[model samples]
Target: MKRPTPADACEVSTMGKMEKVPTGIPGFDEAIGGGFTPGTVVLVAGNPGSGKTTFAAKFVYEGAKRFGEPGVYISLHEPREEFYMYMKDLGMDFRELEERRVFKYIELLPPLGTESIDVLADKLVKAVVSLNAKRVVIDSITPFIRELGEAKARTLIRNVLKTISKGLGAVTLLIAELPYGAQVIGLGIEEFMVDAVVVLYQRRGKAWTIPVRYLEIRKMRGRPVEQVVYQFVIGPPEGFTVLNPVPLEVRANVDYRELLKTYISELDEVLGGGLYRGSVTLLQGHVGTGKTLLSLIIAAENAMRGKKVLYISFEEPTEQLQQTLETLSYPVDKLRPYLQILFVDPKSITPSAIVSKFVRRDTLPDLVIFDGISSIRRVIGRELYVHTIRDLCKILKAYGITTIFTTDEKPGKDPAVSAIADNIIWLRFRKVKRGLVRTLMVLKNKLRWSDPIEYLLYFSDRKLHLRKLEV
Candidate 1:
């Protein structure tokens, strides 16, 4: 029996009952639910240097090259040569498409638009009709609004939506810029008139803070799109591709304990059969608490067992991580072949980017560690950290790999990373009546119940031991 489609699923897409356009961007299509629906106008908005023009133009180029759909890019800012040249740097091969007649360009500035473009909406509409173009990209609609005010921009966008989408059956993308701190809602008209509205935003700071690229769909005329913070990075030739996101299934039942096991066996045993294989484990504590040391033990042990291990350090350099491991007398020299120590300080190449580097499911490592969690707290915040960790646990669990992470918990504020872990182990300084000693505690356990809520943990001259202590 044919099942009825849910009412909410209607605006999620308009590509027929089961049709989907495969533009082939790495992860972009999936975030917006799927590719653009036929007869849909998608607005791509972003700040300057946010790769706005580069991303939109490239999408149209892909439609021409991959799907064999003829495309046209209308530039409101630069002339044809400049527009084509600008994208060339980002690796868009528009010249070849133009030669093949599969692509064309039209610049609508005063010089190219002889008559006023605002009053000549038909001229722009005619170009798309004559080219028989199925894909159209207007470089930017911000300046084009110069000739037309808010009311006129609204009417013009409405007309363009009707002509290209309904008349020409074209999948058009309108580009616009967004000012910071201000909620620019696609001229408010484009959002209502278009089938899909995609917003591109730029954020600056450290590498982690250096926002790669983010896309949000405010409206999808009638189609489904996932609402997730996607790492949208457009590499040289490919243009815009989202990082491989964690599959939906992994988010719910990730086993964090099993991942803890791949790091340290004793810790695993204490953790009761290791972290839940698919759950995220947050290892956070105070300063000088040996978070980094704990990670080394997990990495070296996993490598000794012939399982691959990856240790990423944001605060500590690679050389520093290795030097610190030597103090633990870890068998780092033995499993050097199987262990991978990646030193990444840049913010843009985030935890999610690690997923892009580990696609080889055929031989995925058995254990992964994000050593010293506190240091990375600011790089990828608590909220995003949860999402990334949730997705990470699912992917690692699907491959049966274990992961261990460490974070710093301030004195009073609860640790931000604790909730996501399957098992949470903490290390902090505790002063006993006799002396001040570093303590380790089983704050939370998603794996199995553990006895002795708190324990006296001490490490001296390469030896680590724990003793039962009063909480």
Candidate 2:
């Protein structure tokens, strides 16, 4: 297992002749110009439980498992067995790599003086040489800097780590412990010494109620840092995954004149026969105005027509939605084959992540219904919410997927959201002689002229009924 030379580690790029070694983290390589340049030292700094260790381990494990590039992990804090067990839980079987003689884990306990730093460096070099490792991670250099002072630690990094990176042609990921809520990354000097710096944050902010994990690339040598911050999650099966922003491009090469009928004859007539194949429709109304029911009806209608429909409810659970369908007399068992229902908790995921998961798919659905999208706006804030929805609609439109978004009507709402939709249907309740009656109005329609007329909407015999109301 001879270590790859600098040339072997290099991957040619269009921007220049620089060589890159992919980190093998999903959605992360693209943010860093394909991957890290060969023989570059990357400093990963983060507070405890911010996934610094997990990120480092994944880098090493991925190199060994996917790239056939051997790796060595030297831990100054974590024990070997515990680290292996934890990594195994995350789907990284380091033991198998070790058995293949391509991976090694060396743990050095603390209580070390200045001399021990040299011994640690020697051990790392020896391990890399023995296994011909191309990836190395030091799970953390914080203790050394704390114990030996910044001056000695700087000397060690410059002489040892950089040498191993350049001389051995191995990419080095040096982990640094950042105190909670601290602005500085790992004693502040580590960033200047490394070729790249990635900071992980676990903190509560305006974006989410719970502590959201974020990955920020403060610096990356020779790479365009177009996006500085990204939401990340560390979970099983995949240790570290970054939620890259979804690319918004209208690439649907479909006929915009084509229409997909909603199966509601009167509503379709009001909507100029049907919705355009690649158009976005907004179903805005106050609560209890049958927004969910109407969206479900559209979804069921499409599903019954043998069209693939995806219904994502941010407010209702899958079981609750199924119950609603049963109560509405919709054939749940029959519609199950074509209609895919998913319940997402707005608090559990970021807006970008949600859009990325559903929109960036290989085979998109024919129609998508987002029920209770107001919850999403509340969770991700206004600006991001608008951007996410705009990008999402663009992606769906490009796939020729008819999308219906249901949001609660509220005062002071940003018009940018409604402006993005190709068509807008405003649902409200009007006081009639017989209590309150539900009304539907087509405020805007891009495909055809929509008369400013309100329709009385109601359900009878499990069927939706609509009638023109004289103004």
Candidate 3:
């Protein structure tokens, strides 16, 4: 190659600065300084469904379509057919690209807990050199590490990233799935070796409350990226789409006082005139503890009073809910004229996805009740259960929606329930010295104080009524 003149060198440098590639992922290219700089390494880490593979495919797809840059996808976990199966639903044509000699797909068979990292590195290098790849993706960095063992794997990861950058001269997209809630910046030797890191997380909430989806990215090479979290989702036509953040005003400051007033007059007075506008009240008790009945009373009464309300009943089916409420003297028909009830059956939708899709943009209800928060929670898993509740509270409070949640407790034991709810409404049936009786107690109210401490509530004549406790 001949050395260029000063003018030619200047032109080359300017063009290099102007050259940009779309990563095929939404919000990702923008996060990585217009696109990966030539020979830069980007580490993308997430739990499953975090779009690790799909994101890499997007990068390859955009390289071909936008820059006419040939790319390669190396798979260690699955074969080429498997890659196609996962990407096909997302409108990817990897097989066609392979046939056209524009893109190459390679799969390596590495044992999960017993693979040699040095051998792995050799395979990676050979693939890059042969393809003359301009862009590259490693579908997963997991199996390689698992096979090589922990300490040795770290060394291999570092060397692979360093060698790839120096010899291949390609922008690298390394796919990784870390355990839940792990830090994004450091992953063995690879963390320190990468130029940028992005962590994607999914949050959830009770009933119609929408969980805002976003990601956190840490730039190691001074990439132009905003620190603010941005909403994202995996949808059709566009695989990963990013949405604008919800305006602060639209998400918070509810009126609990009005909500309490809207309920039965005595219940309102018992609750010190009203619950705050934007507050979360949890109904806690054991099975058959009147959780559904209490929700029915609130939903039916509010609906009857011309207030918009949404009821997501997890334990009871729609018809089953109607029949049970009818048996308890709360008929949906009698209350139909006063209020509107929208049932979000959990059988079809996950609680977290519901909040992201429905709670944020749908009807701004005066009250929203997630009958039995435990049902939605069972799907979130044990590790993330606490954080899930906290995020839910934030989203609901921002929307200013008077929210209520139900927790079915075990008999005679209060197991860390207060940590999750803003207000704890404990409903119990206990045998006192006098006799066996039902009890409803307002235990913890985050917004304000209440005086009526305990009240005797009744379900009679197809209606829920209240009376002062006979002590």
Candidate 4:
């Protein structure tokens, strides 16, 4: 399956006769459905350290640097020298633009004892016209209007922003600072006043390990938006990057017989000559039904055949897995060349964390084996657990990787893992007249017709043996 990029999934309607202006920021244009309308007033509001300043600066710098449009950055809180160094650290050379006369900086200090809203608006409008600036950013409108009260502040933004936006035909970004944990964005009137309102904040991702920055398009007037909450990251080179959810389309190409050859002949026969390539096989039974041993057998065989295999065990350590394989008469040293064993503590594992680690690997394996997957269910919730398993299966199968997962389930009780598995091999211990006996049964097989017969399974010569029961 090919994953759809942000460019492919976000297709906004171009029916309206609105002239769109590109933000020059990657993945941001898609959020606003192909950028903002020209000469629009946008409010970038958020708490301190929520990337409000950087967001506004990036827009300004991008417009002046890449889009051939001069911009004005009005600083009310930070010094010009400090702001120059800050933007430079973020890989934006604002000093160069200023030298070329393509960018301007307006500094309006506080103590506006009698300066009315109209006065500030007049200064901003003059700056834009003097520089012929197409883009303008007010570093912050919070302190500037705090003394005016919410009612007066609302009037100031409503009057001032409309004047600048319409007077000079410039796209303006007003930076607003809301107190931490504030319920509303700005004075709650900014959303109504501005043509677009975007809020930036930090949210704990699915894992809750690190706080992820998110940009929310609360309101984009007169434009169709595809996403509301977008995950973003601010770092060097590219100041901001959005982690968009790409839709996956899976297409499988496999030879069922060739895939099944990775297993021993005994297990392969019961699996309709071989397991289907790209099929998720689940081995379910009680604790001591040789589930780990079986999963290792399949992994070890494939590794010895020069196929790459990745084995992940949540229950045991890597040393323990290696010692056990050695004790089982398998050549652990030779097998190490093609196999990689990873032991993840189920207590500390998250679906997003683990999946990200897997996909980001330099190379992918031909087979993925998960032993003791039942522990994952105990750590992650049912919904997330199922989602993790299905996501891994789909991603691996899309690359033609065979998957085998093991779990311990009670009799007649279908576990959630069964839903994602394409084949289910149930092993259990039964008490017969001859004492305790181990048997293998097929609960489901998508490849071919499987007879409902319990086969006798035993260990002989340090290898697994499977055969039909004598009548």
Maximum-lDDT candidate: 2
Q: Give me the displacement of residue 293 in model 2, in angstroms.
A: 0.7
Task: Output the better candidate (1/2) by lDDT.
Answer: 2
Query: Where does candidate 3 have its weakest 10-residue lDDT segment?
Result: 3-12
Note the Cα lDDT for every prediction shown. 0.66, 0.82, 0.64, 0.76
Clashing residue pairs for model 2: 11-20
Ranking by TM-score: 2, 1, 4, 3
| Candidate 2 residue lDDT tens string, 344-417 | 88887766566666533645677899999899878777787888888787667656778899999552266898
Each candidate structure's count of clashing pairs: 33, 1, 16, 2
Instruction: Give the per-residue lDDT of model 4 (tens digit) for 279-362.
Output: 788888898888888888888888888988999999999999999889888898899889989898866644644554444345
lDDT of 1 at 96: 87
What is the alpha-carbon lDDT of model 4 when measured against the actual structure?
Answer: 0.76
Q: What is the lDDT of residue 360 in candidate 3?
A: 32
Better of 1 and 2 by TM-score: 2
lDDT of each residue in 312-358, candidate 3, tens digit only: 77676667667765676665787665444445555345434444543
Give the better candidate number (2 or 3) by TM-score. Answer: 2
Error of 3 at 84 (Å): 6.8
